[model samples]
Target: MTIQFYLNGELRREDAVSPTTTVLDYLRVSAGKTGTKEGCAEGDCGACTIVVVRKNGDDEPLYEAVNSCLLILPQLDGANVVTVEGLARDGHFDPVQTAMVESDGTQCGFCTPGFIMALFALRQGNEKITDGTIHDALAGNLCRCTGYRPIVQAAHQACQDATKDLYGELSPLIPGEGYEHNHQKFFAPQNLSQLAEMRTDYPKAMILAGGTDLGLLFSKDRDPLEAIIYTSSVAELGEIEETKDYLEIGAAVTYTRILPYFERLYPSFATLITRIGSRQIRNVGTIGGNIGTASPIGDTLPCLIALDAMLTLYSKTGSRELPLEDFFIEYRKTDLKPGEFIKSIRIPKLKNKQKFRAYKISKRYDQDISSVIGAYRIEIDGLRVKDIRIAFGGMAEIPKRAVACEGAILDKEWVEDTALKAGLAVTTDFKPLSDHRASKDYRLCVAANLFIRLYRDLTDAEDLMEVVAA
Candidate 1:
């Protein structure tokens, strides 16, 4: 079986390549498109950035910049991929490339291709161009020799207008169901029934959503995946069902697809999502994958727990709903049974006088794991704490709620002193470990200080978020 995709506007089919082969290796080794460099095999560096154009449910073209290093060959089975080499058309450079040349955005040119591709996707977006958007778009791509001044200038000059000419005429494809090469099976089911059947048959298959996490095994570790069940192609798993009480997000929904809802419902959580990784990571990363990973420092876990999210786990037998907080059993362990997979996450909407705030404490603003993440959902009645839920990450073996902290502030006056008392109660709730990212004491201190920050934030302080010098 062959995996089919449009590479640089040319149809390409591969049957000999391993399904686990990363797009980076496939492009450089097989396709001989070396313009996309491999500075870091991991997704941290933007050197392997590439533009993937796919259609959404509405049949609208979605131009996304993703890390080629972290994407497998089957993941691009029905999409149009644009590399840096594809930017020039008819002997003329794309506007972004011209802008980069005129603005002197390249130094050694190793990372230039990634930057151009990132900007190429940005230029295709309809979002209003601003300094913040420009920085967010370029955050995934890093350049050492050339400073960001020219890069910023180039973004300002080029991305001010959205372009639809490139790949606009390309039609969407009916997603391929599955592929196999050399006994390695890759299943891409289009519906829930098919997924359930496949899950029951191949219970040990690596379930891939965005593949940002499991792709590491294929890219850096060179692990051989005997079987993979790709979930993104499943229509039901990609739906976003909204009700008056809650928003039900399919487990396969990408972070980029769900950011708009978060921006409207939970702005602070949206801000935190932007920092989960760079735009490249978010373009393909899913919150369900975040919860499944069950990392102590998973940025979305604490926020989802504080918001009281619920999960819909599906299996051949049936589906069961579980609280998001209770799903994590221990460090890097979850309550998922064999043949069971996450179907959707349902997050309840905020009620009257309710406010939510989440803060991610990391060394860098973007593309860094959290040192400590604190999330709060508090309800107030005339300066009195009516109800509150607090959850923290990077503080223990699992993303846990601070019951002691909540008890400290519940039914008390929402004041500085009350916030401080809750902060002190953090000691009773968790005993964080000392790791390379931060010390135990430092984490405790920061976790405590986040309460003060949350207090100030809910009280309508001008400086809601801390400002750092760039």
Candidate 2:
């Protein structure tokens, strides 16, 4: 079978390239589109950013900026891709490129292509242009020279004027085609039943969603797989359903698609989501992928656990529902049975008098792994704590709840003294490992101090927590 996609307004049908070939390598080696550079093969750096155009259910075009290094050839099968080379027409540059040149945003020109593509996505988007928006859009792109002043200037000028949708009139391309090359098979299922059948057949195949993490095997480690089951194409897995009781999110739903819901329902969670990665990463990454990784420091795990989320696991025979916390068994492992895949996550809405707050502590503000993340869902009655749930990451083997810490604050008055007592219980909850991001003592100290911070945040004591000049 052949992998078909539109590369720079031209259709590309290929059966020769390996199924594991990354879009970065394909662009540079096979297609000879060297304009998209590769700085870090991993998704951290934005040097290999590319714009992917796909149609939503309403047939409206959504242009997303994603890391090409982490994208496999089959992942772009039915989308329209635009690299830096595609930004010119009739001897004229795109507005973003022109703004970059006018503002002198280029320094050594190595990271220029990535920045231009990232800013190009910003210009095409309908978001209100502001300093914060520009900063959030370019957070993934790094510039060693020619500081951000000129870049910010260019963003203000270029993104202020809205651009017309170029791919709006085009019909949506049908994707979900199985591809095989170099003895490797890739199954892109169109529905959940097909996904279950593929999973039952190729049980050992690596299940790929956004490929934000698994793509590292191909792009960075050069690991070859016998088969892969792509879940992003399954129509059932890309849905977001909201009910009066809860919000159900499909496993294949991307972060960009859920950010709006989060912003409205969980504002603090939304703030933490923005800090997960740049727009490029969020445009493709998914919460289900984060939960599937089962990492101790997965950003969304603690928040979801604190919120009492439930997971629906699917198999060829049937399906079952399990609590989110019970799914994680050990380090880098889960309770998923053979041939079972995550179907969707059901998160109950916050009831009256209950508020949710999440805090992520990392070295750098953006694009950095967490040292310790604390998430809390608390319900208060007068001055007493009615009920509370606290979950922490980077403090144990899996994203686990602080059971001991929660007990300390339960049935107690919501005051500074009670908060301090809970902080002491955190030391006994878990003994974290010392890593490059933070030390064991630092993690413990921070994890405990977060209780006080949360108390200050909920009690409207922000003035007292502020530091005074010596």
Candidate 3:
């Protein structure tokens, strides 16, 4: 089969490129689109930023800035891709390029293309062009020379008058076929039944969603696979539904797609997700992958486990439900049966009387791993605690509930003094190890202090626990 996509406005149909070839290498070698530079082979560096124009459910084009180095060729199978070379007409620059040059935004010129493309997407978006928005838009694109004042100024200048985007009127390309090379198959099933059959047929196949972490195997570690199944193509696995009790999120839903829901329902949880990675990372990372990875410090797992979320697994034979807290058996181990795959996650809505909060303590503010993440759900009946659930990451072998701490907080007065007792009770829980992010003692101190922080924020006038500005 052939892998087809619109590259820089022209149609590209390739039958020879391997499934493992990243968009960065493809652009430099095969397509000859070198304008998109490769700064960091990993997704962290925005040096290889590119815009992908794909159709949403309503068939409207949505543009997103993605790291080309981590983006595989198959990911753009049926989409419109715009590189820096696509933004010019005869020698004139796009609005972003024009604004940059006019506003003195370029200095070293090494990271210009990535910044241009990133800002280009910002100009096309409806977000207000301010210092905060501009900083977020260009967070992935780093430049050591120009500083950010001029870039922010250029972004503000360029986005002053919104105009038609380059791909505004263009029709979106549809992914209608799968590809195979070197006898390796990539099954892109369009429906749920096909995905189930494919999963059963190839139980050992590597399941890919967004490819944020999965691509690291090939992009950075040089680990190649034999067979793979792409979950992004399965439409049903991307649908989000809200029922009377639970919010069903498809396993393939990206963080960007789910952040708004979290912000509206659980603001603290949404705040922690924004700290997961930069805009480029969140655009492709999925919550299902976080649970599937089963890392002890996964930013979302502690909150999800504390919220009593459930997972819906599917197989060719049938489907089953498992609690999120029980899914993780141990370090790097999950209770996944053979031929079983996660289809969706059901998160119960927070009750009116329930108070939910999540805290993440990391070394740096952004793009950093958490040393300790605490998620709490407390219910109070006037002065007495009705119920309390506390889960922690980076504080145990798994994303687990603080059973001892919860017991101490249960049936007690919801006051600072009771919080102090609960803090001391967490000493009976698992002993956290010392690491680069924090020491064993530091982790425990932070973990214990978070309980007190939660109490103070709930009882005090200020909401110091709420995360803002990113």
Return the number of clashes found in candidate 2.
0
Q: Alpha carbon lDDT of residue 469, candidate 3?
A: 18
Q: Pick the candidate with the highest lDDT.
A: 1
RMSD of each: 3.2, 2.1, 3.4
Model 1, stretches more than 4 Å misplaced? 161-163, 460-470
RMSD of 3: 3.4
**Which whole-number lDDT from 0 to 100 does residue 120 have in model 1?**
88
Candidate 2 at 342: error in angstroms?
A: 0.5
Q: For candidate 2, give the lDDT of residue 212.
A: 91
Q: What is candidate 3's lDDT per residue for 1-470, written digit by digit as tens?
A: 88888877788898898888888989988888888887778887688899887665576666789888887888888878898899987787788889999999986646888888899888877677788888888878877655888888899888997885666344456785477889777778888889888888888889888887887877787665777888888988898998778798999999988988999889999989888877888888888888889999999999998999999998888999999999999898999888888899999998988889999999877777899999999898898999888999999889999999999899998877788888897789869988778888998898999988898768745433342211
Over the stretch 23-141, how does candidate 2's per-residue lDDT look in tens digits?
Answer: 99999999999989999888887999999987766877777899999999999887899899988877988888889899988655568899899988888877899999999999999
Query: lDDT for every model?
Result: 0.90, 0.90, 0.85
Error of 3 at 15 (Å): 0.7
**Candidates ranked by TM-score:** 2, 1, 3
